[model samples]
Target: MVRTLRTSRASRALRTSCAARPEYDSAPTGGRKSARRRTGTAVGTVLALIAASAAWVVGAAPSADALPNGLALTPPMGWNSWNKFGCNITEQKVESVADYLVSSGLAASGYAYVDIDDCWMAGSRDAAGRLVPDPVKFPDGISGTAAYVHAKGLKLGIYESAGTKTCAGYPGSLGHEQTDANSFASWGVDLLKYDNCNDDGTSAQRRDTTMRDALANNSSGRAILFSLCEWGVDNVWTWGAGVGNMWRTTGDINDSYGSLLSIFHANVKLAQYAGPGGWNDPDMLEVGNGGMSFTEDRSEFSLWAEMAAPLITGNDLPNSSAATASILGNRDVVAVDQDALGKQGVQVSAAGGLDVLAKPLAGGDVSVALFNENSGAATISTTASAVGLPASSSGYSLDNLWSHVKTTTSGAISATVPGHGTVLFRVSTGSATSTGTTHALVGASSGRCLDAYDNETTPGTKIEIWDCNGGANQKVTLTAAGELRLYGGTQCLDATGAATTAGTKVELWNCNGGTNQQWRPNADGTVTGVQSGLCLDVTGGDQPAGNVNGTQLELWNCNGGANQQWRLS
Candidate 1:
């Protein structure tokens, strides 16, 4: 979506009297708030301040007040108009797209909503102060369009701004929230994408919460899916769960590989903030938009599904290429996105422009994505145990979502992915289990062993690397549950803080079967943590002299350095 304000005669006329100034229509880059001046009338300003203060106090922690509208239990899959058609949308275009969604089998695969983005409304409100549909663009009006889409067993979504004027300079619903909401519900709108433009400097939480309440208490009592487009400012993901069904976690995404990669890096880290009723939106999909290659487009779809992001397509459906149709229509990939488990995938391994993501499913299955962000083909690999599966000696099944090829691996899952390409797989572990083999883990570089500091045997004792003297403290067992057990299985190697990031300290903790304590001894002689997907390093792995005795072990990116390599002996 274009970020700058679009000034039409109608928008210009309306802006002349409002105290609020024009800003970028899209979210500010780098998660920074816009610098545009904000102003409102005396009463409006005072009330906004009060609401901001109240939200700041009550929203100090993540809000649990997610709308109980019972929609978007899984990220809503649909087609939006902003990315492709932009302000060129029309009733015929929307209706045609709805027909294509059904005829092309997209709706059967879960692409249900046909949403109209910005510029769908008239330049000004009607005489009764309610928003009006653009006469020329939506000739049948929103209600008529909704009826047509509903007749096809699909839903209709509409857009509005939470400011005095929309980014496109049309009248917004800032102060006219309830009135606009009543209009939307009465018109059969099933969803609302609320943008942030020409805002009055009130806290984003306050503005979004106001609209959330208005939609909830609207006179029609319709259950409208709330989508917040604040562009990630004010840390929307922190408390967005209670405010909207989904909240944008980054700026608008263009049809480019760089934009997709950048947004992926930003949104993937916020997996903890997304779940059943709420989700972290990385903006709509730009697949089939032609800015990126077919490989890149597929990568975008795979990564979004891997992240459990809302699969709202922003491309023209009728004229899309077969490659686009195949990518978007892959039921296996879509299943991962619509998995009943509702868990967002976490990046288990990322190094040298190669990344591996793993998401657990509801029925003992796991979906993994091996993404190569480099400019050339690269072989990316991860073990079954590394992706939260038990090290099954009987092997695990890997179903390639894109290729429709099935393969089995004893433990290793590897693929040579092209540049900007993704290898998506659904891994299923049968009855295989980890072996209870006990051995001293000898560091490949230091020739030292994994040890509990000072033989403390405490829950939080530091796990370090020391001389391999066959001591009891150095003996570790690989348990069936994917844990490294010490002291006769009493203590397990744990990534402190349950952290998934690198440099997390390894500690001795009681085996509670938490993912943080899961360890996988890979065939490459590297001991990796299932939770962090990081290697058990001897600290300072890149040092020239290698690690010293008593150097505490921490989780670090798997760089194949000697310090990160371990041998079970």
Candidate 2:
């Protein structure tokens, strides 16, 4: 059973906590894969694992190599079977997807696993009581299906429940964990989605444990990629170690930006638990599902990739449009997920609903995810300097992992992303020189960068983006502009600038430019508005109009609130 990450056929899959729950139901598109963690001893019975090394603490994140599984599955990248199009799955759909993955060269690019989520099985079990394939649906049966997939140079995957019925109300693994695991192995199933649905808090652990034990025991000769699908209840981080290849660490993900932000912020602290044989899953990504803006999807993909979460595609493959595939096909971003060392990124800063995350890879290159979780446009800004990098980080090589563009960093860096979008970058740890044409920001023409909002009204108001001509609205500098200027001039972008701090207002009166507008970019990836000095609040508005002169702004602590995001372009 010892092997590399099922993804690479070269390394391994990889591990976290949190109590955030979600409203559970189904609009019929399918269901959300689900989170939490538990404890484990750092010590291990190495005799059993010839292909791996040191054991990981259930809840405690082990240093790089200390993870039970090798760094094989970091940044696991593949297409899911939900989202853009839900469970309207078909055999031909998977085949076509396999075709697309191979013909399109995506499989070689790391989209190796073609997974069939729940419902691929029939409504009835075989006479033996094991779940059966919907022969009418999967005419070739899973084994044939798997053979077909493997023929296309891809691996095959399928889903099951640890309950009496799958999330779709068909057969499950509940009382038949061992039976199902063995059956899956028999069917040539390489990956298993052992879920915890139909099980509440008490039964959740029981379901996960029983299913994991079954999968491990049955996966004797061949390696099986195990994905534990319990919504992070009872702190799965402490209990998930060595339980599966990757386990869900949060509630089901929705098509909304807030949903993604909530999960992403929650995963930062649990970053240490991820590595090789196990990982902390943030549920499946909702990219290309139209549940969120392209920006939000980018944010979703980027952060998850940076966090080394699984790349389980949750939409119907054939039905997935090119845009959806494009999201899944990003190689640079995928590289962060498929990084050799496999480390999940941690949030360095968040405010105005913008998140700054960074993951260290095998080489000196570092993967950074700049996520805009807001419902509207935001100019998310942060510099390598803001993330505790040495001041020498100023001119590091900045490559846009998403756009696939290479540039250089400046004293700081700023990226503008639309609602829900993200900008991912790989920063090389080396000296950089501004070629004027090569820097991502700044030059002889960039002048200065700033965001102006008269956030003196209620929170969640329209946050306006503007050019920093040093006018009254944009004349603020990074220092005490003189004195307190609590919410004045242009609109309220509150003076204090704490990302997670809540409750401040923006007002526009004059531009005496006090500490309210004299804020500095904190090393934690947060921005200080300087005027009124409060962190800029998004006020909960989903999409703000650009250059709106009377935009009302509120202030709050800087926990990456969407309103607090600003770029100096």
Q: Each candidate's TM vs. the true structure?
A: 0.66, 0.62
Query: What RMSD does model 2 have?
Result: 15.8
Q: Which one wins on TM-score?
A: 1
List where candidate 2 sits over 4 angstroms from the true fold. 1-72, 84-87, 200-202, 319-322, 375-394, 417-419, 431-569
Q: Would you list the C-alpha lDDT of every candidate in the order shown? A: 0.77, 0.55
Tens-digit per-residue lDDT, 1-569, candidate 2: 01111222111111111111221121111111212111111001001110121111122233433324332344444665644334466787778878867655566666778877766877888889888888877899888888898888888788876655666566767678788888888878777767554433345566677776777678544456777776665676776765666777776677677778777767777987887667889987666556654445556777777888887665544444323444565556666776767577878888876878877766456677777666665777777766545556346777665433345666456676655667777777565422211111100001112324442244433333322223344433222332222233233333333332345554443444445534443322235555444554434422322112223455655544323443221
C-alpha positional error of residue 386 in candidate 1 after TM-score superposition, expressed in Å: 1.1
Collision pairs in model 1: none
Write candidate 1's Cα lDDT for 1-569 as tens digits: 34532333233222221111111111101111223222222112212222221110001122255557777888889999877777778999999999988876678778999998888888889899999999998889999999999999999999888888887788988899999999999999999998877777677789889999999999989999999987777788999998899999987788889989999999999999998778999988887676776577878999999999999998777665433565676677788888877889999999998999999987778999999999887899999989999767678987766544355788888987777888888899853323676777765444457888877897899998665556778888887788889988888999998998888999999889999999876533467889778988888744533445567899998765546656455
